[model samples]
Target: MRQGIVRRVAEMALRIEPNRTAVLDWILHTPLPSLGMQTTFELACNGEGERVIALLNDLLLQPGDTVPRLPQSAPPALH
Candidate 1:
């Protein structure tokens, strides 16, 4: 489940950012405004991994929007 979450987040990042290194860096270091300024890496550690995935999915829903939706159910499979 952890790997699935990571892959889903990375896939979403690549769809928008398209740079693997930058996406990884952002995931590990950058605090997300939507996640209440918590970095993605941090959220994942505290049982909030689904929130990160939900944010990515919400981002895809609104290409230019930055507001994050409330976390929902487990994300769909990558394939």
Candidate 2:
């Protein structure tokens, strides 16, 4: 069950580092302070799979201005 959650996290982290070994290593070793200083795998073993997923989802989120922009002042309409 722990491996399952860890693998799921690795799958998500793959977008950051395509290699399975490196990504797996990261998930197994990287300490996430936001997760109470637990590594992804450790947090998963503690039965917090959803939280780990959320962390990865946040990681996968692209940085950008996601807010919809208002249209500029319109030109005069034709008669």
Candidate 3:
């Protein structure tokens, strides 16, 4: 399910931003807790906390702009 969500979000990012490295970097790296999300990229980072922190160096992008998409497929598969 998570993988599906990620893929769908990637597709949307491709469509809307069309290969914007900063945006992708933000998506893959940003710590979402600042946006009041239940889960944070920090927690997701597990042992790689420093790397995740470094990835989130830029927080100028708003949370709304980085909302992830649901996969078009009915069932989400794990990557």
Candidate 4:
């Protein structure tokens, strides 16, 4: 059950990453503890969780605004 929830969440994260509002809504509405990964999910969903969502939203932007580049380079090369 826990694994299933984590898998779903991970899949949702991948889909939501490109959409800021969706990500925000998801994190807000989803039951963190119910996902069966309470410790990890709660740690991520604490007070600063919203801020993290916002930050991710900002990072998804394409130019126009200036934000420091993520330390990592291009996403890992796909096979």
| TM-score winner | 1
Q: How far is 74's C-alpha from truth in model 4 (Å)?
A: 15
Give the TM-score (vs. native) of candidate 4.
Answer: 0.28
What lDDT would candidate 3 get against the real structure?
0.41
Candidate 1 lands at a TM-score of 0.69
Clashes of 4: 0
Name the regions of candidate 3 deviating beyond 4 angstroms.
31-79
Model 3 over residues 6-75: C-alpha lDDT tens digits? 4444444454446667446645654344443322233333433333233233332336667433112133
What would the per-residue lDDT of candidate 4 be over residues 1-79, giving only the tens digit for each residue?
2334433443445553545555445444443332343332453644334433444445556466554332122345789
Total clashes, candidate 1?
0
Off by over 4 Å in 2: 1-3, 65-79
Best by lDDT: 1
By lDDT, the candidates rank as: 1, 2, 4, 3
How well does candidate 3 score on lDDT at residue 70?
Answer: 17
Distance (Å) between predicted and true CA of 45, model 1?
1.6
User: After TM-score superposition, what is the CA distance of residue 69 in candidate 1 from its true location, in Å?
Assistant: 16
TM-score of each candidate structure, all chains considered together: 0.69, 0.68, 0.34, 0.28
Per-residue lDDT of 20 in model 1: 90
lDDT of 1 by residue, 9-77 (tens): 777778768779988887787777667878777787776879987777766798555753333334457
**Count of clashes, each model:** 0, 0, 0, 0
- Identify the superior model by TM-score, candidate 1 or candidate 2: 1
